[model samples]
Target: MPDSAGILPLPLFSSSLKRDTSRPVMLIGFQHQGNLGLGYLASTLREHGYSVLTCDFEAETSEIIESARQSKPMIVGFSLIFQFYIRKFDALMQALRAAGVDCHFTIGGHFPSLSHEETLRMLPELDSVVRFEGEMTLLELADVIGTGRDWHDLQGIAYRGTTGVVTNPMRSLVDDLDSLPYPERNFEPEKALGRKALPLLASRGCARTCSFCSIQTFYRTAPGKIVRTRKPAKVIEEMQAMHEERGISIFLFQDDDFPLFGPVWRRWAYDFVDCMHRSGLAQRVIWKINCRADAVEPEIFTAMRDAGLYLVYMGLESGNEEGLKTLHKQVSVEQNIRAVEMLKQVGLLFEFGFMMFDPGSTLESIKQNLRFLRTILNDGCAAAVFCRMLPYDGTPIKDELERAGRLLGDVCAPSYDFLDPRVSKMYNSLSQIVDVWGWIHGYRALSPQLNWAWNEVAIMERLYPGIDGLEEYRRRLAAVTKKSNDVLFSVMDNLLEVAEFDAAERWDNARLDALRREFLEELLRERDAFVEHNQSTMLRVLRAQPVQEAASA
Candidate 1:
């Protein structure tokens, strides 16, 4: 075991005119819970013959400052992903400045990739923000710093001096993704921030540009570059590393749309399946990956399952055909239905990530979505994790929201939690929908108290109760959910006293089991309730439609 010292040393670079010295580059992965970027970059840097250290940004403000004090490098990089993490990173730098620790600070990832200019303006302690794909840019930046050479030579950087943001053009995308080292095999995973399911990146950039997306915009920052992926051999190498080094077989593929780009991905999938067999990896492990509805063809979906993909996270963003069309989803309602059915036919498990309410959607539209979801869920692949449309900085929706004055203050990039005010405001709408939805399904496996409260209301209203309007219904549901969460947390707290698992693992298997059961139970009651409401609403609306048509006729 090595000390923090020499981990990211800023050895004064001896010029090539005198002698060449090694430059130490520290790749800081973002957030307290598992870092994929730094892990990848750490291995990348080490391969390039640079000293590298990877660390997670913790809640303790002193953590970065303390680490900086202990091992100050030529370049201190923070692997920023979400917008909230950027704010937290700013605070970390402020803490460091307060404590008198001055080291060259930098950041990269999704948020910074889009808002590098604003990031530099807001966070004064930051030296530069890497704009595009970071692996090469970061290495070059550290090289310049270690040598104390000209800053102008570095590409893909946004830095501030007396004149303010000096933006450099981003480097071209890595031509060959297969040439890069695997992050898991190259760096450490299954450690730090209490995450066991190693998050892996199979590819970079995206193929589609739906109106609500930022990935399309961000990827285009480096023009003419198509989405790139590592060879299947490399992907399996990382999995093998996870299995061998961390004993982690399960993974979460954090790709934007993994399976969509047909032939390239299929090659990787076949190689992956071959490696899984050759390496003797666990057959039962769940490796979840997300893809667009049109990406999973029946044959390809079957190939994926053959390769040991246990779960496919489908972003059936909206159930309504018009809503999907409005969002430029490119896939039709029929295509989505077929995709889900394909996954089911292959005997693979999956869950729905749905957006029931679009910005312009009304109550009627929501009911239509409910009917659509009911048909989809009828096949039993409907464990819903509701997500509202997130407006990223460079996305078209963000621009639209800004023009309409609906967006407030740097509300584009989501923070570390992926739930900022802008998005969470929508989440508030989602919560309302969830409550109504929960009332219909009983909120089982989702929110226990909500189920209990809704059930009580149902029982009360049935047994000779007056009308409990929306407000009264909401207040009672809130109280029930609050009480349920409190009891669950308290029980867990007592168990923790006697438990041997660390605080991070405390949120693992047992907790997930408890949460899931509660959610399912609550949802069962909610489903029945939803059915009743939906049928009534649909009949009324259907009758009204014919009457309006008759009048027009």
Candidate 2:
């Protein structure tokens, strides 16, 4: 439509390897280690007459980059879902550049789609960023880029030029999902991928706004504004195929919002769970789904658990009213509490996410949050994650924070290297907040930080003056904290280093316990120093508050 015939990027396939119409163009769909976006992109690529190469970003960035060069693919795409994966994306892009290879380096996923400008700014090596619904955009891109024409004119793509940033309008949402091909796993059907669990999306987009969120913003990409999902039977078919084909036993429902309609969700949950259970598929397969905290009912929980539901990922983003109010999360704390209790009593395991930092938070508000966790989920059945608020540019909250001048001018930072020279120690304070939130929440919300950890929180809050009583909560969060930390760390560690997981498994029993104790000791030492440092810092911030307010006024 827009003179794209001439502007498309060219694909660089191996010269020795003759191109055949039957030989599908290679589509590289990569996500981080043991990730499920792996499923989404891989499946779609295979459907559109393309062979797919899949890999994890956990391999050294150089490794991922080098592999692309060696494979000499037609298209190399990275799944930039997490903010931390930016460095790896750049590394791969760089490798493509170094080889002078014509491989089309593309990125399109939840995180990148929302922040296309950021992607352009950060990873120039990427030829372009697909703004939304990558399966189609990628398909069309491969056709155009491989043909050496005007993919730059294609809709829903973001590329740059001497003139400036060129952002093609988002393509209309796909109306008919039934005809879409199933998600393709990367490896051969004969190979066993072992028992690592992953999340899969049956639908695209969320319809609700839980304050401290970007879900609603993500939903806006679809033109008509409706959550689209595959038929329930097809969902079952995909799972069945994966189980039979790839030996995949566990699946996570990665929908922005599963069962957007309450009644529909109930009906689907009942039918699907019962169906899976009846067919004996549930025996071999377990699932984890993401849904509105309030959408789940006692019956749904019961049916889900009976159907071998391993976990239901919940977004409890906050414990109190104030935090929920800020994000406009459209649900109540009571609803959250009720939903959580039902899941627990129904024998369902849940991983609920909570956020501590907010734009207008006060000391009392923050404490109320900690107290909520302390009071509510202090057991093994449910968990809480405490993440910080990132000023995602497309999120409603981001708009609010930006207007209030609390939004960080630059939300983009260096990609986290969990195994890097400097940063493997911990994510920056913001990212630490994210991981710690998950860590603490993972142990069932009642988990406390070690003495030293709490002490550190206290000291930081004091120094920062707005973070509230983290040190105090850390101290109180003891047994549950230790166990929760272990659970959260262990799951993540297993997921992060699956190849070395076997070696790590040997120490799981005693070694995990020992690590917990060792972590506790480290927290204790850190806590003492934290107290002294924050105490002085708190006094300074307090004394300056009056002057700060006056200057702003």
Candidate 3:
């Protein structure tokens, strides 16, 4: 039990028997992109003398059970990153329990942290939730569980109490992000054209309050500074170490909003760029970041480009003013266009998050969005992509929809209808079409594959510059991409027309499928040919050999 100061007294070790430190604490989560949340938690626990093991949640049930049977973990924690996976995780939890691995179960992430009551009710297997900013909280929970002490009074925890689900007071956010150790990377680094790419964070939280995003609210609800940044020197030091030790050449900044927000952070960005140059890493590595459209100013962005900024991902959530206003993006359509133009002007590549359909969307608005995509993507600077805005949990838009009694679907997959029923029909059909062909991971997706091929060309331009046919390869890839974009826009145009006339049934999907197939075949053939032609260069790059300038152009 905790004392009057609300802190638990140290657990006294038994004279005869001590807690077995061999029993590890297991963390299970979706490790598709190397989940930093679990990485930080594992590192934190290890820092305080605890053994940690992790398993991908997508692993087979039998495999997970086998691992648990072998490791015999004392506690099993789930990283419930998104609500969509709630049902899946519940199934895993049930399976683990049925296998007789009766360890203390716990979960964490945005959904469980924000809606603890519902989470507790949904996954009754959980012993507690290590809520927002889980490093210290999880560490404390591990200590108490290891020593067999009661943890009901622990801050930043929500558990099933006697009367109901009781959420204790939240812990303050970590003030100095630099104080925390680097995330323990257990998964393989992502590859961008034979160059190793790893995700890095320069800051913790975002300052903007986009209606559809819970990041701002997640940090604001906590009891500390909203956004905390590590010093540029420390960030460079980490980069230097990773580059020297791991041969990592690409860094993906996964900050919610990178520290390029306003005047204060502009200075930080400059300092970061300067550090990159001073540490001599500016020319050695390239990186990408996610930022708002309005944050893409010319001077700073160009400076960033000079300092290894290869790609920028802007949240251009909407095309028109009305849609932007509804999404609370606080930026105009012109600004979005200008941001793309500025990126192009400075010779930096970019991708964007565009919502073609929102709650207030109509046929006209959808068409406006289509035109906007054309405006930016006509040159084939990047792949054409768009998605319906999802009203995720703890977002203002979710609350707004709930108050108006328009929110539909289950909590795991919440959705709503557009204002017009015809628009709904249109979107429903469009979504099916996209899922078939244009979706990033769709079976027939062509644009993203081409986009990746183009990314390889770009990477080669930097790392293997002056290769014999690099320029020609880039030009051919660009032409193929522009043609693919043309096909996408044509299909969208036909869909819009069909929806307007209420003839979605008559929409010729066979013709579109044939076109996508042709492009996909061509893409594969072209990529294979290029690889065969550049066999020596490809082999050298794939083997991670030192880059050497070719004899001649």
Whole-model Cα lDDT of every candidate shown, in order: 0.60, 0.58, 0.82
User: Candidate 1, residues 258-365: lDDT per residue as tens digits?
Assistant: 845577676776676677667655342346688887877777667666655767777788777777876778888888888888876876655556765565554444
- The C-alpha stretches of model 2 lying farther than 4 A from their native spots are 1-35, 187-196, 380-384, 414-515, 518-553
**Best by TM-score, which number?**
3
Rate residue 96 of model 3 by lDDT.
92
Could you tell me every candidate's TM-score relative to the true structure? Answer: 0.70, 0.69, 0.92
lDDT of 2 by residue, 1-553 (tens): 1132222222333333222222233444444324455565566656544566776665575666566667677777777766656766676667668867666678877677888777788887878887767667877777665555577888778888778788888877666666767665544321111233445667776767654455566667657545776777778887776665555556767776777357776676677776786677765556667877878788667766666675667777777787788867778888988887887677565666777555545445555676666556555233345655566556766666556654544555411112232222222322432333323434322234342243233224322445445545444444445455446444434423433232233223344445546555654565555456446655565345334222321
- What does the lDDT come to for candidate 3? 0.82
lDDT: worst 10-residue window of model 2: 414-423
